[model samples]
Target: MRVDAFDFELPQELIALRPAVPRDAARMLHVKGGVIEDRMVLELPDLLDEHDVLVFNDTRVIPAQLEGRRGEAKVGVTLHKREGLRQWWAFVRNAKRVRDGDTVEFGGGVEATALRRGDDGAVLFEFLGDEPVELLLERAGTMPLPPYIASKRGTDERDREDYQTMFAKEDGAVAAPTASLHFTDRLVEAIDAKGIGRETLTLHVGAGTFLPVKADDTADHKMHSEWGRIDAATAERLNAAREKGGRLIAVGTTALRLIESAADEDGVIQPFEGDTDIFITPGYRFRAVGGLMTNFHLPKSTLFMLVSALMGLDTMKAAYAHAIAERYRFYSYGDSSLLIP
Candidate 1:
């Protein structure tokens, strides 16, 4: 399909620079059976039943945005993937100034030498000291905000807590699973009281999520791989819930992708631990997840394509039109949508 088919006009002011206070205060648009409804994120518990299970991505967003200097030339780095305990593949700004084997010095004395360059134009850097890369990042890095928001304003201390969900635990992701950012402790308690089961899996969201689809056609686009894991026990539990006629509600596209990658043709989820480059587009069959709760995506983005697949393309376009006219926010810090095909 032509990528241009997914394009839509969005007013610049609709993009959210900051998240709604209390997290759950964000707006939610419910799309089910070709019908759209306006609602609030706090009302999610009312939309779900006791037999439904919500799967969340527990991968924590790391402080992956870094600033450094390569012989007086300023360099910006956003770590995308972990190659080893001390080695990472990062997309560098002003990359031409730093060659393979060049050392870049970051804040707090943290330094790394570029081991090589990846085919995708990313630099492979190996941290130079015994201190774990995680520690070095904590000392010298800032939260990796989505380029849409970061481009409008500078990142600050508020984003540190706002970008992270209450379920964050495993540390690896460079980007936050934006859908999960709307969750709060109060919302969790409410959902639990309503007898809805919640489970978590890890998918270290990479900076590739922010990359645009420059391809003219969907077939020409290649999705960047991200590491994810689902254990046997969790898989078994999810299968059991489904056996009892429970619907699997994925909390974000990341969770939806990982769960779909772990499921078989029969829709039975299996234990998985590897990288997934699953590119969901229209005409794709969804086997594991039945419903998705996610943020409104950008025009011509892979995420929009996924949502279009879940619902009909025309239906999503109408839904998005309503969202825009209603003055709902957009992007990572934007409003939420509950999609049920």
Candidate 2:
């Protein structure tokens, strides 16, 4: 399908620069079949049933943005994927000045050498020390905010806590699973009290998630790989929930994609550990995930395409129109929507 079909006009003021206070105070638009209801994140417990399972991505966002100097030239790097313990694939700004084998010196004595360039225009950087790269980043990096927000303002101490979710434990993601950001301990307790089961999996959302789709057609757009893992025990528990007639509610699109990638034709989820570039578009049939709770996405973005696939394209368009008209916030720090097909 044409990528233009997913395009919509969004007012500049609608983009959220900061998250709602208390997290659960964020607005949530419930899209059940064709019905739409405006609600708050705190009301999520009432929307689910005792037999439903909510799957959350436990991957934590890292300080992936680095500002460095290669000789006299300034280099901006956003680490997208981990190639090794000390090596990462990064999208570099001022790429023309950064050649392969050039040492980019970040502040506080941290440095990484450009090893090679990937086919997707990203540069491979190998850290030059024996200490863990995570430690190096702690000294020389900042949180990797989405460009939509970053372009408007600078990242600050507040974003360190705001960009991460309560489920954050395993560290690897460059981008936050925005949908999970709306969850708080209070909400989790409420859901648990309501008898809704919660499960967790890891999907290190990369900076590639922020990349724009420049293709005219959906078939031509390529998704950068993101590493994810679903252990056997979790898979078994999810299968058990399904056997008991419990619906699997993916907390975010990252969880939804990872589960769908691991599901078989029979709709059984299996243990998985690896990279997935699963590009979900219209006409794709979902198997493992029954419902999705996610943030509002950009125009012509893969996320919008995935939501369109979940609900019909026309349905999603109408839903988005309703969201815009209702003045719900948009983007990573924005409001959320519960999409049930």
Candidate 3:
């Protein structure tokens, strides 16, 4: 399909710069079987049944945005993936000034040598120290905010808490699973009281999620891989939930993608650990995930394509049109949507 088919005009003002205060106060658009309903995130517990299970991505966002100097030229680095104990794949700004083997010195005693460049333009970097990479980032890196928001306002102390979800535990992700950001302790308690089951998995969201689809056609676009894991116990529980006639409601696209990657042709989920470059597009049949709760996405983005695949293209276009007309916020810090096909 043509990538332009997923394009839509979004007013500049609609992009959200900050998450809604109280988080759960954010509006949610419920799109069920082509029907649209306006609701609030706090009402999510009432939206599903006792038998339904909500799967969450527990991958914590690390401070992956770094600014450094390679000799006289300034370079920006956003670590996207972990390659080893001290090696990472990063998207380097001002790549023209640096070469393979060149060392970039980030402040606070953090430094890394460029190993090589990938076909996707990301540079492989190995940190030049014995200390844990997480510690190095703590001293030098800031929260990796989505460019849409960061381009408008600088990242601050507020983002250190606001950008992370209450479920964040495992540290690896460069990006937060925005859908989970709307969740709060109060909301979780309400969900638990309603008997909605909850589960967790890990998917270290990479900076590639922010990359645009420059391809003319969907087939021409390539998705960068992101590491994810689903243990055998979790897989068994998820499969059993479905077998007992319960729906698996993925809390975000990260969980949805990981679960789908783990599901078989028969839709039974299995234990999985490794990278997933699952590119969901229209005409692709979903396997395990029954519903998805996610934030609004960019125009012509892979996320939009995934949502379009979940609901039909025409249905998603109409749903997005409704969202825009209703003035719901957009992007990572934007409003939420519950998609049930």
**Candidate 1, RMSD to the unseen true structure:** 0.6
By summed lDDT, the worst window of 10 consecutive residues in model 3 runs over: 120-129
Regions of candidate 1 where Cα sits further than 4 Å from its true position? none
Clashes of each: 0, 0, 0
List runs of model 3 lying over 4 Å from the truth.
none
Clashing pairs in 3: none
TM-scores, all models, native as reference: 0.99, 0.99, 0.99
Q: Name the lDDT value of residue 188 in candidate 2.
A: 92
299-329 per-residue lDDT for model 1 (tens digits)? 9999999999999899999999999999999
- Which is superior by lDDT, 1 or 3? 3
The TM-score measured for candidate 1 stands at 0.99
Q: Candidate 1: lDDT of 142?
A: 99
C-alpha lDDT values of all predictions: 0.95, 0.95, 0.96
RMSD values for the candidates in order, in angstroms, are 0.6, 0.6, 0.7
